[model samples]
Target: MKWFKKYHLELLLVLPMTFYILGFTLLPLIRTIILGFQNRYTGKFSLSTYQALFARPDFLKSISNTFVIALLSLSIQIVIAFIIALVLKQRFHGRSIIRAIVLMPMGIPTIVSGIIALYVFGTSGYFNELLFKLHLITKPINWLTGNFKGLLIIALADMWKVLPTLVLLLLAGLDSISQDIYEAAELDGANSWQSFRFITLPLLKPTITMAVLLRAVDVFRIFELPQVLVGKSVPFVSTFAYEEYDIGDLNGSGAASTILLLMILVFAILWLKFVDRGGSFGNDS
Candidate 1:
């Protein structure tokens, strides 16, 4: 009774969050895992659902497409976000206005962004129209036709929507860095490139890893942009699972969902290991 009384306020603060996680996150994850291993009809243990899922050619394609989109989008986002963050870190006239403009896309709805992408890239879209007006092309260029082209467009569209969030994260990381270090490097006659390569990049490693991990996980589950832009013509793991669910293949959907969850888990583990090894190497150096 005395112990409870002493920690009562802390218990009150934590209990609700603990319960929420159990009720919402943990319960759902346990249920999904169970469903993945169970037969949909008899509710008996079986591997048939997983077998069927892997036998489908589209499922394999979806897995590949997921990786392609993730890599492309994340590559574009990180590079652009880093550059933008660096620029935004510097003080200039109307800097606040530029930052607000840069972050505006983060506030837009995903569906809305998808639609905007379609308008710009579709058959009668603004891009082809502009090219035609410029006499650059006599016919409308189908930008989202081939697998590479379609996937590239989807990746770019996703980047546009999510880039602002990454920029904010990197900007925060940059802000945490001390200006004194930069001034000291300048005084020691280190050039901009040398200072950035040695000081900024190394110090920013943890933040970069965090931003990449979060974005990679999110990108792996991409659905809406591809769904809106090209439908199931370009499949992602999330979309594949949704398609199974839509078609009443509950067990297959569960299997796909399980695979996706495992993929994310493995990727996260590998990333953490790589980061740990890199940290050790730095220490040794």
Candidate 2:
């Protein structure tokens, strides 16, 4: 009671967010858990929905594919963003213009990005036209047909959409580093690479960890890019969940959703552990 009175201003600011989470997140999560355990058709409790979901090899494949794509997409987005941010951190004329250009991707809608990617990667798309005009290939490639290419297209689209956000995050991280540290390194005869290796990367670890965690979760839950690109018939987890829901397999969908929620939880824990380790590393210094 005494602590509450002391922190009352902070509590007042936090209460609205607390209620919002309870109303939307907590309530929906509880409902989903209850619904997943029941037969949607009969409204009776049963485990058959989960059993049926697990019975398929495709379901397993989708789960595996989701992780693979998410990891690859997140890695690519982070690396590209980090490189761009580092380059832009240097003072130069037109630096602001270049930074604004990097952020342009975030302004475009994901659906729009997906559509653009589809058009570009489709059989009769610009890529084929360019390749054929150069006599690189005689026929247009069916880029979306195979396992790897389909995954690549989806990852590419996601990477495109996500790159701007990552760049902004890394830029923010870069800005947080003290310029005095760089000056000290310069005084000690350290080169740009040495300064970055010792000072910038270590300080940016927390921000990079945060960016990776956010991007990983977003990529894991991605639907429209892969779905619009390859369709629901493709074995990706989000598409599979949508397919189940579309076919009125509500219980199965819920169970699959529950599994996804659990997967997210597991990843969340891992990310937290990673962040804690990074924090400890900072503390040790």
Top-TM-score candidate index: 1
lDDT of 2: 0.84
Per-prediction TM-score to the true structure, in the order listed: 0.91, 0.87
Residue-level lDDT of model 1, residues 154-255, one tens digit each, is 888888898898999999989989999999999999999999999999888878888988998988988888889888887888999999999998878888
Worst lDDT run of 10 residues, candidate 1, spans 276-285
| Top of the candidates by lDDT | 1
Off by over 4 Å in 1: 1-3, 132-136, 276-285
Candidate 2 C-alpha error for residue 157, in Å = 0.8
**Measured by TM-score, how close is model 2 to the native structure?**
0.87
